[model samples]
Target chain A: MLEALLRLPPGPVDLTALDPAATPGLDGGGKTEGKAALAALGDPLADLQERLFAEGRADVGHGRAVLLVLQGMDTSGKGGVLRHTVGLVDPQGVRITSFKAPTDEEREHDFLWRVRRALPEQGYLGVFDRSHYEDVLIARVRALAPVEEIEQRYDEINAFEAEVLGAGTTIVKCMLHISADAQRERLQARLDKPEKHWKFNPGDIDERARWSEYRQAYEIALERTNTEVAPWHVIPSDRKWYRNLAVGTILHDTLARMAPQWPLADFDVEEQKRRLREEVPVR
Target chain B: MLEALLRLPPGPVDLTALDPAATPGLDGGGKTEGKAALAALGDPLADLQERLFAEGRADVGHGRAVLLVLQGMDTSGKGGVLRHTVGLVDPQGVRITSFKAPTDEEREHDFLWRVRRALPEQGYLGVFDRSHYEDVLIARVRALAPVEEIEQRYDEINAFEAEVLGAGTTIVKCMLHISADAQRERLQARLDKPEKHWKFNPGDIDERARWSEYRQAYEIALERTNTEVAPWHVIPSDRKWYRNLAVGTILHDTLARMAPQWPLADFDVEEQKRRLREEVPVR
Candidate 1:
């Protein structure tokens, strides 16, 4: 199962792989290095989209269940990936669930209630805009739970996701790795642009102040929860174009490996032709 | 603009056209008469699904906007149509918005703001599991609004839907027509099965008592809002199989007419051949 998901060969990562000790914008982390990574992503956006859509369709037809969970900070381009990626595939076989503040009834239940209900059925792809990882991420960052409780939830989430995967749901978890500087730039752009103003939240600036804490929480979340069943991809998202292409490539490659089966022809041509000859009126 | 929208026929509907007013387990409703209508649907299952998926893809390609609104009372088979219809289309291009209780921000604005944001972009389809019509249907049936306010809402909804359609969005409104007896049977089915017990609600029994009032509201909604631009299809959903087939057929047909364009091929055979010829080494 693990071998099936490896589509693209491991290339050199574009960014300094999340080294907190490294000096910010030092020689090792120059702007030119980022550009080189973007260059590494192949050109021609339209062709890439077409290939992704075809791969997703074939996987669904094969009756192989695949679930993609997008977990990231608010400005981490989760919505952008959803809008652009789904724009390529047919909507029939896909379901996207955006988890918001839990309802009174939902709050009474465990966090997984809403998420479990939103999982894609067999022969479908379900995308969670944010998922159960929140139980650990938010709980750890905000100290919503006791330290022991927070640590315990990780095992529960891993077990829960493993069960889902065991039941034929292939899981792909993506953590959009954006730096503090990039987050500030995106949030500011949302405020600066009229159409994107709806996306900007004044509270997000405060969240940005505690960026280090959030980054620590995310790093822990990835390190602890990353399993063979649902390994997390720390996608470099400073460049939105490159981020979209990288995620798109991973998804396209994964589905191609799953190789969903299509239905066989129901009728033979000779039999159908003979029946048509007997039943038809003169044209 | 309205005239052009009106020119498009509501397409295939009334899965049980000959069996109108038919209730489940009742001989008088001419229930079996739906055979011809079901046959008219053409695609038994796969064909219907294929058409629905193809048309949805076409709408996205042509950059033709489409909005589908489904509304009905309890046990009206809203879930059935949604399950079967959406089951066939590509899930990526489709967005299903289920309007439950409004949020704090939603309450601050008019009912349409959240809905406006949910509208499909160019080359996409937006599905309303329940729509703004709730302001009229539920409000009127429950006596939650004054008679004048309810009447005002009907007109507002009609105009609002027409405006969206004029802006190049194809609006398809389907009212699942399940008989009163059929609803009781369905609600009971939920209660009888252990797995389905979660779906059972005692409040549904009380709602059945006010069935006539709900019917009156529906009749008015159908009459007032049925314009040439966006007509309501009263699908006879007492027959589950027929209901799925009819709704699927109409949606497929409407989308087919829009004719979405596919991504252009980018691989140039001539250039490839020339490059190959130049690169070929003499043995």
Candidate 2:
């Protein structure tokens, strides 16, 4: 239910249409109920993750993987989703990459270089805190790249994703949708708390002032890069619990559908058992 | 209390001397009690880890980090400790590396070369599933390397750790000590279960048969390489719950001692607050 509701549809994505405060697919409206629902999903999420990892370890049926790409304006709770949602799985089975502004070395190559290098191996869940979409979103909003270069990235991203899909990597891109009001409150909270002061940046005000421009950039990026295979999920962000629940539900649904089967042993099981018990009996 | 009980002393070590089923430092007996104690430590563990991470992110003081290295024979519950103990922290701040049999490329370089690359950055908790100590353990037992070369590794390892210590990385090494009978049952359980069959390698039986040699190798490795800076702790691993609790307590204690402070804001707080409220007043 959350999967179908949160997964962005084709043709156009307008920021003005969707309410960031709306809880679309969640069963209960209250915070306590929403959190309990998420906690309940933990065991099953862990089970599927272990199966996926077991498949990789034993070279099971499909050499497939999942990539979760998170794109959000500052303080949209990307870290919260990562901590509360993805934390349900065994960390060994998950590969997380946080993309900062490119270093000189990263900038020398095409934007996708670092991203491609960080792709998860088969049977691992790969997460991108911020991904190559930055090339379009921030690059367009700030004019950080040439106009033509920025223009070229949409199709380039699609093509790159197509190649990844062909290689059996399922891409789940989520645009953490937050209201300007939500951002203001969160930024203020950061300012208010001394412990959270490290998270606050003075430049955030400069960006916060240009909220509409960044929102427009996201709409463009969403419209251009959204694909049927790798649909974008617009998670409402005013409520942290709901956002986490929605993303967790979507991921849970995706993995359940994938339903990785445990691989059959390559060696003779009966013979190994005999050898384990008798031939190499306990000393 | 747990740290003192588990920390190996400055002398020759004997595996037969420590009872694998013994639950020292834990107040209550049984699996339920041990698991409860570990669960209680989760919040404090999470808190300390975040502070450590904050220090790294903001370039806070000292720039120190922690590395937990696990060295164990087959079925000593290394995976359990990782899932139950290290899993207590945020996965984002934890860097875990499982060192398998070195590749041909890894062989071309010195063993420590790969170890050096996998070292945790400042303020992160790095866990090695199997580590450089593998070069000493299996390499010595299986005669995979030369006698003279293995003899030199102890001194070389000490020098290498001294350098790592100088750079502010605290090394905590644990040898998950399980009895031969415990390993037999663990191996038998894997053989008995189909879902776990993927984890069973026939070669494990061959290794199991040579249990005494491996124990002797571990003892030598512990004696020769153990230093004041990075002593080896042998956790009795027959009871998986007790093992997890002990390792968790040791890690919680280590991080608490480090007491990483939340980084102070590097910018002007009052001015940012003003700019945040006045210049960009929620549009």
Candidate 3:
């Protein structure tokens, strides 16, 4: 199904073992050379992305909003994907919102409170760094809330996404898939660097310890929340280059489907000239 | 002075024009070759931007938040300039907030209330589409409140922006300058397209009729609010490509000046490999 949906060449990472029911195994162990695919993307990916962005910008005339949801574990290349993907789109029509740990007030309301307010306006794109999936993932992993409450969030998130989709928002959820080894290396890198010291939290190691648990949480979240309107794509992120290419490709495909229109339907040189004439006052 | 500024080969669109006492004609005549620069950026630009983004991504470190305020008339190309300028930065580190007419609750509070909540986190870029300046501009133009109250708002805005900058946020304010004829064409384009129908507001025409008042209000705003820390750039909007290039160049230059550092003090493959072997558990 994934191969048919994507026209780009398949990435080198083996996904045959990407079973939601079972845990992901060793990095680069299944049957593919991840390094080769990353190198293959080359320079064309960027050009393709810009073209897609320009098309999306013009298409805002269609009065539809595109909401891109980026969810991944720590150091899973969410930042990389966002930086590259949004680089192509016009900044005027795009808004990127990052949802961090809930503030005191945020904890007081439903998990979706902060997210709902960040929805994109008609004819714009809204990118969420870490979405409401936290209500299921983090809350469940940390045992921050009761089990029933955590499970119920999946249904609530689905309904919430459905409502937004019905209201002219196209939601594209991407789950960045990274290897345990890669994440540990990244986390260690964060600790090693003085500037990155602020990013390294001891709790992250604790979360790393609960790797299996988090995986289960992610599986449940994707399986329950992934639907017709807001489908989740599991992008292999061990290769930052591949992660960027996959995201750019997905966004390009989706925007192509939406097909935003240009501001002017019919170019009228006479009208433009007339307007210009009126504008230049005889000073 | 305008010629000298423009001759700098599309550098940061330094907002010196905002000084009411410094230069008078600058509000309408500032040159914007930003879009041309963007197109000219070519492969080198892409390569640099990708490297910059990668550099930005590797550290996972945050930097001072730069808030760009764009305030102008309906057809002033505020959207166009924003789209082009932000296109040059790392989206993961940027946030754009478009402030429109306040909601009922917003009206009850001081004009800067909603804006305060949307302040970007440190090391991120926050671009205000139409910001607190509206309290002074729209309130004065639309006669939403009294003259004394409106006059007080100018200082309030200046002070507010200064505080944000003082709190480690870099504020860049831009006002798009469009000829009367250009606006008419843009409005007509909106009206001409079925998809764009919603964006075309008859009220904008009425506001355009009071062009003199808006111009005067904007003049006073530029005079009183442009400060050392949070300056405003008046960008020429006659040519969309030029505007994009000009704004994009300014932003690119601004980020370059910031020179966001990677948290890593140095690269150590041996240490990384050692840490992985010792700390990382095998599945």
Candidate 4:
């Protein structure tokens, strides 16, 4: 079921063919069981993260890391996924970068410049709430760049992900698939709640007006950039619970496959213990 | 009680005069009560952080932020304070940077250049596990830089901190003070436990040999760079519980004084709510 979501086939991708409301990854269980499954993953996820962090600290060069890129339409529950899924791990082992509009200085460099700086160090889990894919997604929808430049970015991103994967970083890109109806409901809720008004931007309506164009952009992005090294998973995000579960499962599986072990210490442990116990003078 | 820990007086300071084990900021509460007090601060700290984050998002220029700089020797529990004290707030509102030995690129720039880049954006609580103070602390003790360069850094740091503080950023610098006896016990414990061996570096012993020199370096730093905008606090860290309590209290108090409020909405609330309810057509 998860394999169906992975846009791994080398063919033209059609966003219209996929149902955003489908929960193919879930078992027969509903939201209640989905929540329970997510809860069950907590301990093992933390344990795996500890081993990963320990591996990074023990050996820098051989350390492995994971980078999860989350791209979605407005109100697609990126914040919720961050709070529920990524928040479960130790903050020490996680590095999250929430990309906003680029700054003047960032604009001076290539799009990948700021991104390379924010990559997770060895043995850490790096998350990008919105990532370099924005160059192709929004840039394409709004025609911010020349059509040729936007065309160039898809290949550039593919090459970039290949380079990072070669350096022992696993990449998982998830597009939080949501219907326009779901987005409208979420945006309306944000406007209705005074506390949430801070998150509601009127510009989102304008973006929604260009929904078809954005969908076209994402379709092209998924088709062009999905490679064997880095695949894009179109998660059914209409249900926030299932979205969180799928992401958590993906991370758990990735970390388990990496199977980072505690690195062996350089010094003689018994000798060091003896020295600490007997020879070290306490002031 | 917290007043006693603040080095607010404008005068020469001596590190030897301070007691590393005294719980000056904590009341008559022992470790048990200190732990409870730290736990008790969780909600209010989270609340204050939300307001700060909201303000940053609503208005970029007018938003306020806090930068907490923690400097301590090996085994002084900087990692513990981060995991326990700073970890209480929402991760979105907090930016934690653990600065190691500078990279070759970082070394090419002025010391403050890398630091300036890492400063928390408006509405964030920025924490430096180890910070630029290393320039004047380790660099001074090890004579890594020239005598004149080390001396110049004190003023340079003061100016740099003043510039940040002037821009609506409140800076709180903490020196986690642990006695040599406490440090020996910690380092020894790390060596005795195989899992902790990764954290124990052999060069720490060489640093332990120059304890007095490092203390002198800290003394000069606290005296010369402590300013009206950003003051230094000597935290008695021999007791982990009390250390967490003191740091948490300092943050709660500092944030209370800053008093970030939820920003007022720019648009008409009722109109937006009505539009969301009756006007905007959901597809």
Model 2 spans > 4 angstroms off: A280-283, B281-283
| Alpha-carbon lDDT of model 3 | 0.65
The model with the greater TM-score, 1 or 4, is 4
Give the alpha carbon lDDT tens digit for every residue of B97-117 in model 1: 767567798878776788888
Residue-by-residue lDDT tens digits, candidate 3, B59-94: 343335567777777867776665555655566666
Model 2 lDDT tens row, B68-123: 99999999988988888988889888888888999999999998999999888887
TM-score of structure candidate 4: 0.91
Identify the leading candidate in terms of TM-score.
Answer: 2
State interface RMSD in Å for all models: 21.2, 1.7, 6.7, 2.4
Model 1 CA lDDT for position A102 = 74
Off by over 4 Å in 3: A1-16, A19-64, A184-203, A256-283, B1-63, B181-206, B236-274
Minimum summed lDDT over a 10-residue window in model 3 chain B is located at B16-25
Ranking by lDDT: 2, 4, 3, 1
Worst 10-residue lDDT window for candidate 4 chain A reads A1-10
Error of 4 at A7 (Å): 7.3
Candidate 2, lDDT over the whole model: 0.89
Summarize candidate 4's per-residue lDDT along B66-184 as a digit string, tens digits: 99999999989888888788877777677888898899999999988889999998998899989999999999998888999989998999899999988888999999999988998
Task: Give me the overall lDDT of model 1.
Answer: 0.61
TM-score of each: 0.50, 0.96, 0.73, 0.91
